[model samples]
Target chain A: MDVLRITFLRIVYSALLLAAVVVLNFVMIHLAPGDVADTIAQSMGGADAEILAQIRADYGLDQPFIVQLGQYIWKVLHFDLGSSYYYNRPVTELILERLPATLLLVITAQTLALVIGVVTGVFSARRPNGFLSHLVTIVAFFGHAAPVFWTGILLLIAFSLQIHWFPVGGMRDVTVTGGFWAHSFDVARHMVLPVFTLSTTFLALYSRLCRASMMETLGSDYVRTAKAKGLPMRSVVYKHALKNALSPVITLAGLQFSAVISGAVLVETVFSWPGLGTLAFQVIVARDTPTILGILFFSALIVIAGNLLTDLVQRLVDPRVRTGQ
Target chain B: MSFLLKVENLRIELRMRAGVAPVIDDLSFELAHGESISFVGESGCGKSMTALAIMGLLPEGIGRVASGKIWFDGEDLVAASPARLRHIRGNKIGMIFQEPMTSLNPVYSVGEQIAEVLREHQGLSRKAAWAEAIELLDAVRIPNPETRATAYPFEMSGGQRQRVMIAIALACKPKILIADEPTTALDVTVQAQIFDLLRDLRRQTGTSLIMITHDMGAVAEMAERMIVMYAGRKAEEGPVDKVIAHARHPYTQGLISCVPHLVAHLTEERQDLNEVPGIVPGLAEFGQGRCLFASRCARATERCLTTRPEEIAFSDVHRSACWHAEGM
Candidate 1:
């Protein structure tokens, strides 16, 4: 019951914040030096003043700022995010179409990174002074410090250009036809380079964080107790130490979900994956107000939703946290 | 007499950057079936290290048992294979640690933790292990055993957690139990309760116990025989009451005097609480001279500093290591 209340409160708070941000975005764009009128005038090769006025009225650009914002908010509340001027489709439809591709890439990459990172971290922590641990530390340092775009380019050069292992860019081959499986496989195939690129940075960070947390937990008294009980070293590391270590990792992963999506914008645009990231970039460049606002709202929702899910997962993993909440 | 555990000439050395001698030298002791003995010492006297070495759970890359023979039930534990050692630990030799709050895995339920030991040692099914876990919890006198078993370690109080630890250690009814300051962190009442529980357990199962502690009160209450350690070497050993009443070793005398007695007249002239003067010598560059305690001993002489005192027998059961043992 309390959880329901908290969730409801969070939703309301997020809605108000997102509404404020959208209004601020509208105000900032209006205050910019150029306008849609000027852009249309330049594109039309010195159109007459009367024709320009007609074009502005037709696009509702001549409306008062308050009237424009109120109409946008009402449409948004009614689940109608208006048609995109550039894409020639509803903004919602465009975003929805690209959502699946981005979700597939981000979710798969995050899951893979978490699994591999956590396992390596636990192992490294258990053998702090071992060669494997030192090697992992060095690799993680490089992975964290290196730029994601640079890493992506390097992987592209190595895997695509040299080995000819994967496609260089884009979501899928134009020839792939029919059904869900084929589309998914095609999308996944094209996702290889970009996912790997985005995951490298997160993988390094998660591993380093897990290793540090695990190392600290391994020195804790419970670990000693487990050892004293004569549990096998494997059990001690995985069952005892790893569980506690994951709490911090969960928090980091939650925060990183937002970062991953934001970072994905650059990667998606570079790779041309047709995800929200690419749509967002294109929409912002075109200054298509509805499309830009739709993407902003969705990004905010993803971040807030990701954190909420993390909270729920943490509650499941640790009962003490549930009671505290 | 048949002994269940015997540790002979156990020497632990710190692997120093520069050359250094062993930290724990020629330590020897034996535990007969159902007997409880304690190794009492000041902090950093290598008491806990001795326990860790026995358990084969020493910290990585620092200390090693240079030479020793740890015999458990005719088996040489020091030379035992890792697999064999794993079987012996928690099965034949259960151990309870000092801090109960940190000693239990917070993620697992108390019952699950206890069941882990049962499943590991007894090869019981999870269901059977859990059933045994509840019984063990009940034996430990924890209220609402069923509910408490489902609770995490962090949800319980310190004393309750310690009780749960004891319950888990005794789950398999191991032949020997090593309790390293098991009740040190508890209040007086809780300490007495734990001691009583241990005593009851010993009486019921004839489980031999090796308790490591610096508390004289704990020693007097629980152990039948006591080995007084200073600077990682045995300074005295005897029946607990006899040793407490008439300590031959000067260090033992100082420790006994330091124990606050209820008799006001007996403690009215107490002066040596802080007067023991020097701190325990560091393991690095420690002397191999006549007496490890000679530097702190008020009765030290040229002979004390020149030649190490041998273990001298006061009786068949009482022994002291001091040059002036006869006079003292």
Candidate 2:
């Protein structure tokens, strides 16, 4: 029952957040210096006045701002995102085609970062004065401070150029057919560099978060009580301490998912992974309003959904949260 | 007569920023089979540390047993291997801590937490352990054991949580139970209820108990014998009634006098309550050569500052560590 309520609330929150994103997108596009007609004309080496007017009428760009926004929202409710002017495809179709690559990259990277970060954090916290703890802290500090692009470039240079181990750029080798296994393997291989680069920062951030949370949990009287009960050191650290510590980390992981998806724009461009980042980049350069707005709506949905999932997990793990406010 | 637990010259040295010194110096006591002993002292007097040392659960980097022998059921716990210690802990010697609110894991249901000890120590099946958990909870007099068993620590009140802690400690029916300030965080009403429950449990199971606290009232209520500690050393030891009625050590006298007595009618002359004049001396400040509480001693003399007072016996059962003990 509590799980149901949590899911219901998440859906409502997602809907409200999505509505706000749509409104912001409309305001941004409308407030810009030029309309889609003008942008198209500029791209096509300047269209005549008649052609511009015709294009304006065709796309309903001649309507008032409020009327256009209302119509756009209504169309979105009916699952119609309109067609991309440059791509000459439905906006939803365009988003769908690129989303898998982005999803594949971000999810893999985030999962890897969470696992490695949490484990390292737990170990570091357990043996606080050990050599490994010092080493982890030092690495994590640099990983968090360094830029993703710089790290990506350095990794590319080392793994792709210097050592000649992995491919220099792109999701896959040219010779590999885009079959399920072949494409996935190619993507996975190419993902190592960019994902590793992106995850270095995430790893650092999460480890720091985990360490702080773990320390607080360790200091909690219950942990001391558990120790007093004479439970083995392993059980005390992992079962009693780590479980409580991960609650905040879980929440952070959910919030970070959205940030990672959004932040991947820069990293994706660097590695040329053909994800939403590249698509968004192209749409921005071409000033393609539909495609850009579509990606914004989609990303906003992902953020809302991620947060909702986090809430559900929290409820499951912690009964107090569910029973309380 | 077999002794369930014994501590002989148990000196626990804490390495602080200043230097190393004994937190529990030459503290010796024994809990005979089914006997209940209470260690009473003010805060930071090392009562809790003594309990932790017996359980072998001292916090990291704070303290170590400098020199001691903790014998539990013929086994030297201080010298036991980690693997051997694991077998003894929770299985043979269970412990309940103070602050019931924080003693149980917040994430898990109370039943699951109790059952975990059963499964870990006794190797009970999940179903059997859970059944036993509810039964133990019922034994602790927790209402609606079946339903409350599923409740998390946060859902339960302070009293209920303490009961659950008691349930967990007794899950394996260990020979000895160590309760460190078990009811200190509770209210007066709840404190009485918990004390009653502990007494009832002791009667039913005949398990030896070592209750550590700063409350002399609790000692009077529950303990058969009591040990009073000052500056990490035993100041007085005797039957609980004798220690309360005729405290030999000045520190013990001060502690007993501080407790408000109804017999002393409220008057203007009694307005000022009895209070110890000084704080506990820093372990580093008092070296191994001299008495630890000499500076704070109202009866201290030249000899008191230079020489550590050895335990002087008033009787075979009652003893005190003080040069002025005879005069007192």
Candidate 3:
């Protein structure tokens, strides 16, 4: 009963928070220095005064700000995000088309980075002064410090031009017509640079976070108790220390999930990946208000879901949290 | 037959910021099967480190058994290989720790934690090991063992957690059990209950026990023999009753006096805390070629300050390491 109540409360709280985010996002995007009227006129090829008024009426841009916000909120309730100015399509449909690509890119990057980072962190923490530990530290520092776009461009120059080992841009070659597996293989070949570019900063952050948390957990009294129980060092570390160490890492992963999607704008631009990241850039450039708001709403939902999952996983892994102590 | 456990000239050293320093210097003792011994000392007196060294659980790259032999069941533990040590550790020698709150892993249920040791050491299947774990919890007298078996450490009280710690340590019925201040963090009532539980369990299992604690009362209640440790070295050792009656070392004298005996001092008066003067010296003063306790000893002389004391026997079983042992 308590679990059900808490979960219900959490969902209601999230819904309320998301509604506020909707209003806040609408206001903040409006506050930014961009004229939807001007963008529409420019795209419609220098519309005269009469045509400008008609464009405003067409996009509902001439409505009062309060009325527009209420109408937008009402449309959100009905799953109608209006239509993009440049694409001339429902904003939801446009976002959904790009959603799969962005999801693929972000999930692959997150999984790859997390696996590599956490494994490296565990090994590095096991032998603090070992060569692998030192190498990981140096690499993580550089990875975190370097810009994602710069990393992407560097990978493109080296792998695509210098070595000819990978595709330069886009997901799969347009000329390589093949079966499903073959096409996927080609797309994977092209994803190397963008995923690598997007994952570097997160990988570095997780490795450093896991390393520090592991070190602390390794020294905790429970770990010493495990060691004293005469269990092998392997069991002592992996079974006893790792789970406790991972809670903070899980939290960092949750926070990074949404940030990674936003950060993909930079890396996706460099690689010209046909993902939401690329569409996001184009929409912002075109001042496509509905598309921009749609992406923001979707990203906010993803962040909330990620955070909820992290909390649930933490409860599962940590008995203290599960029992509410 | 040889003693079930014996430590001869056991020395433990730590690599500190200054240099290598002895934390446990020239300590020796023997435990017959089913016998109980206690090492009583203040904090930083190396009681816990001695226990860790015996179990081969000393902190890696920092603390090590610098020299001497820890003979256990016809094996020299100090020279034992890693594989041999692991074979003996949880299988033949179990250990419980001080902090009940922090000793058990928060991620694991008490049952699973106990079952892990049993499975690892005894090679029992998961189902059998789990059954044995519930039995162990029941043996330790945890209420409703079936329900409590699935409960996490956070769900249990301090006394109950210490009981779980005992259950884990005693799961494999090791020949020797070392409990390092297992009940210190518990409340007074819980402390006595844990002590009673340990006494009942030991009586039943016949496991030779080495309890390391700073509480003289705990030593008096739990141990057959007691060794007074001061600054990493043995100050005095003998049968607990004999040593308590006639403590040869001044440090032991100070410790016993510090504990108030209510039966003898029945007057309702606000008594001052009778803590011993000064404190235990750090590792820097461990090998200073003088008695580590001489600074605090009321009977220190030129010889006491210039030379370290050696163990001088007062009886077949009792010994004290002080120049004035004979007089005292």
Candidate 4:
């Protein structure tokens, strides 16, 4: 009963938060310089004032700020993200079309980063001053220092230009004629560089964080007690210390999930992957107000869902949290 | 008779940024089968470190047994391989620490933590271990063993947590249990309850105990033999009643006087704390040839500064390491 109540409250809270997020994104984008009318006029080779006014009127940009924001919120509540100014299609339809690729890329990259980071972190933590530990630290330093785009370009140069082991860009081969398996293989090949590029920074963060957390937890009194219990060192570390150490890492991962989505913009643009990140980049450049707002709203929902999942996982793993203490 | 556990000239050194230093200077003691002993000392006197060293759980790359022969059941623990030591640690020897709150992994329930030991050492099936865990909880005097079994460490009070720790330590029914100031972090009333529980458990199981504490009152109640430690060295060792009644070392004498309830006169009348005057010397000053307690000793003589005193026997079981022992 309590769990049901708390979950219901959480959903209601998320709904309210989403509404606020929509309003905030609308206000911030309005405050930024340039509007869809200006971009449209510029695209039409510099329109006169009459044409600019007509474009503004056509897109409802000429309406009062409060009236526009009210209408937008009402439409959002009705599941109608206004049609894209550039694409002339429903903003939701465009985002939906691109959502799957982004989800696949983000989820894959995150899982890869988390798994590699935690494994290496646990390995490094076992012998903190060992050669392998130092190597992990050095690699994490390099991962954090390099920019995502630079890493992407470097992987492109190495894997595509020099060796031709994988495709240069995009998600799948246009020339591929086979069915699902071939298409998937082609997509997977194309994804290797982009996923690696996007996940490097997160991987670096998780590994370093997990290492530090593991070291501290290993020193905790309970770990010592576990050792005193004559538990083999393996159980003493992995079973006793790792769970406590992971809570913080999981929390950071959840917070960073949104950043990963934003980070996808650079990776997607670099690799020309057909994801929301590419759509977002194009929409920003085109000043497609409805599409931009739609993307932000969806990203907010994804991040909120990610946080909820993290909380649920933490509750499952940590009894303290399970008991709501 | 062969002793159940014995330590001969045990020395523990701590590696620090500056250099290595002896934290536990040449120390020796013995625990007979089912014999309860207490190591009483102020902080940094190597009481807990001795326990850690015995369990082979010293701070990694920091605290190491410099030289020692910790003989347990005819096996020299210092020479024991890591695997051998690990086998002996929770099977033959159990340990509980001071901070009950932090000493338990918060993620696991009290029952699970207890079950873990049974599973690890006894190789009990998961269901069997879990059943044994609830029984252990009940044995430790925790109320509602069934429901409380699923309760996490945070849900329990400090006393209850300590009881859980005790349950975990005693789960495998090890030959010896090392309790390093187990009750220090609990409330005064809770402290007495925990001690009662320990005494009852020890009596039922006949498990020898090595209690490390500074509370003289607790020492008198919980231990038959007490070794008062000063600066990582045994300052006095004897029957608790004899030593507390006729304390030859100034440090031990001061410690006993500090406990108001133990001193009948002080319990009736309010007074300022009867505390030992100086602090336990730091690691840098340890292992010096001179008496580490000299600076703080009220009866220190010139000889105390030049050479450390050796253990001088007052009786068959009572001993003190002070140049002024004879006079005292």
Best of the candidates, DockQ: 4
lDDT of 1 by residue, B1-328 (tens): 8789899999988777776557678889899988999999899888898888888887767888889899989988889888888887888888999999789887899999999988988889999999999999999999999888999987888899999999878888899889999988999899999999989988998999989998999999899999998887889999999999899999998888777545468646755443366888877645386698988999999998898789999999999989999998
Q: Candidate 1: lDDT over CA atoms?
A: 0.86
**lDDT tens digits, residue span B1-328, model 2:** 6777888999898888877877888889888999999998888889989988987877668888889899988989999987787777777888898989877899999999999888888889999999999999999999889999998888889999999989988888889999999998999999999999999998999889999988889999999999998878888899998888888898898888788756455553554469878888866764466777777778888988888898999998899988988897
Task: Please state the error at residue A150 of candidate 1 in Å.
Answer: 2.2
lDDT score for residue B3 of model 2: 77
Candidate 4: deviation at residue A18, Å?
1.8
What are the lDDT scores of the predictions, listed in order?
0.86, 0.86, 0.90, 0.91
| B69: Cα error in model 4, Å | 0.8
Structure candidate 4, residue pairs in collision: none
- Note the DockQ of each predicted structure: 0.75, 0.68, 0.77, 0.83
Give the number of colliding residue pairs in candidate 3.
Answer: 0
Clash pairs (backbone) in predicted model 1: A222-B102
**Per-residue CA lDDT of candidate 4, range B172-256, in tens?**
9999999999888988999999999999999999999999998888888999999999888999999999998899999888988
Candidates 1 and 3 compared: the better one by TM-score is 3
Which candidate model has the greater DockQ, 3 or 4?
4
**Where does model 4 sit among the CAPRI classes?**
high
Top candidate when judged by lDDT against the true structure = 4
Q: Is the docking of candidate 3 incorrect, acceptable, medium or high quality?
A: medium
Which digits, one per residue and each the tens of the lDDT, describe model 3 over residues B242-305? 9999999999999998997564455767566587999888788896788999889899999999
Better of 1 and 2 by TM-score: 2
lDDT per residue as tens, model 1, A140-177: 88988988778888888899889988888998888999
TM-score of 3: 0.96
- The DockQ for candidate 1, computed on C-alphas, is 0.75
Please give the lDDT score at residue A138 for candidate 3: 96
